[model samples]
Target: MENRRGYSVYQIALHWLIAVFVLFQLFFGESMTTVVDAVENGQPVSTTDQALGSAHYWAGLAILALVLLRLVLRLASGATASANRGPRWMQLAAHALHGLFYMLLLATPVAGLLAFYVGDPWGDIHSLAKPALIVLIAAHALAALYHQFWLRDGTLKRMLSPAG
Candidate 1:
């Protein structure tokens, strides 16, 4: 892990791909729930919201595929051995949070699909995961900022720039 200091171009690309799509899904996915509630309440919902809801479904599936690809890349490319510069505790936390990210990224879509096809209970769990993921994302961003800005380290640059 100490020997490797940077990520390859493809690794950085996959990271950004998943990051962007997940954020997009977070922003748009809730509209689907709103539409569902409207329909359940026998209220007239607009076609746009309904369409957005459908888009959310497809977007979720896209996220699933991206996450899977990211995992495959992570495994095949030995991407995790970055020249991590931080306290041991922070490094461990980073790894743990990343592992959680993968789990939730994989599970959230299944929960969403199940909620869509099975019933509302799974939807409730998916709803709960949204906030948790949001928090994790916020923390992740802040950590990157901390490393780049405060610590004057190259952690953020590792993801943003290709390995030399």
Candidate 2:
């Protein structure tokens, strides 16, 4: 496969890094909610568990920062070849989905931070952001699957493995 124009090595690295962080955030988030519920129910909560939850929350914020950086890079670099070459409707859909992803990705963390500020008594209210993140993730995943399985347009390959 030929390397799609407009995606640099830095962009690729950023994409994969964000992917890992998002997935980790999802896993840690589900667990943290359980921990918070346990504590709320007057059950004993281990300090280690609390620490882990905090770690996940803070790490998610870090990922948010990276996402912002990636957005900047994407804006500066412009769209990939697949984006330019695709049908107008497909391109529009891709852009819309990507926009939604960015909006949710940014909003989720901010909501979590706000929830934390409101004094939820949990280590971090960021866990509350999980549902929103899950929704965005599902959309992102479904879009990818649709592109790969139904469209078969090589959009996923542009991110998964650039063509030489």
Candidate 3:
């Protein structure tokens, strides 16, 4: 595979779109636990909880679909060619972090669906992924900032613009 200077336009869009949806889920999804508990306990659920839970569910499904589409586009286009310009260890770490992002991106929603929709015990997995996802996102954002400001490498610019 040939290394490109940056991701394709679609890849860049998917990256940011997923980021937005993930952030939405993180912040607005707290009501889902209340909604779930209420449903299970046969208690009266508030309309606000219902609306938020519904949004959370649909947003999760959207994230899953988007992730799948992004993965397909990535595989077909070979657009994931390393753009990192750093030490060998940094490159390896970047690759590992990207892999982990994909894994959690795929697994977290599936676990959520199974836990809530299918009544499986995977909620534990979904719960655990939240903190992990937040940490990884912070690291990813900080790395992009580092590349943009400290390294002056246009790494962050690549995602902000599709000129590459």
Q: Which candidate is the best by lDDT?
A: 3
Question: Considering TM-score, which of the candidate structures 1 and 2 is the better prediction for this target?
Answer: 1
Q: Please, what are the lDDT tens digits per residue for candidate 2 over residues 14-117?
A: 88898888888777676556665776699876786787778867877988898899888777767666634446997777778778778777876776666555
In angstroms, how far off is 90's CA in candidate 1? Answer: 1.0
Per-model root-mean-square deviation over C-alphas: 1.8, 4.4, 1.4
Candidate 3 local lDDT, 111-137, one digit each (tens): 999889776477766778779988999
lDDT of 2 at 83: 39
Question: Which run of 10 residues does model 3 get worst, by summed lDDT?
Answer: 77-86
TM-score of 3: 0.93
Across 25-59, the per-residue lDDT of candidate 1 in tens digits comes to: 78888789888888779998788888889988988
Better of 1 and 3 by lDDT: 3
Candidate with maximal TM-score: 3
State the displacement of the C-alpha of residue 87, model 1, in Å, after optimal TM-score superposition: 1.4
TM-score of each: 0.91, 0.74, 0.93
lDDT of 2: 0.71
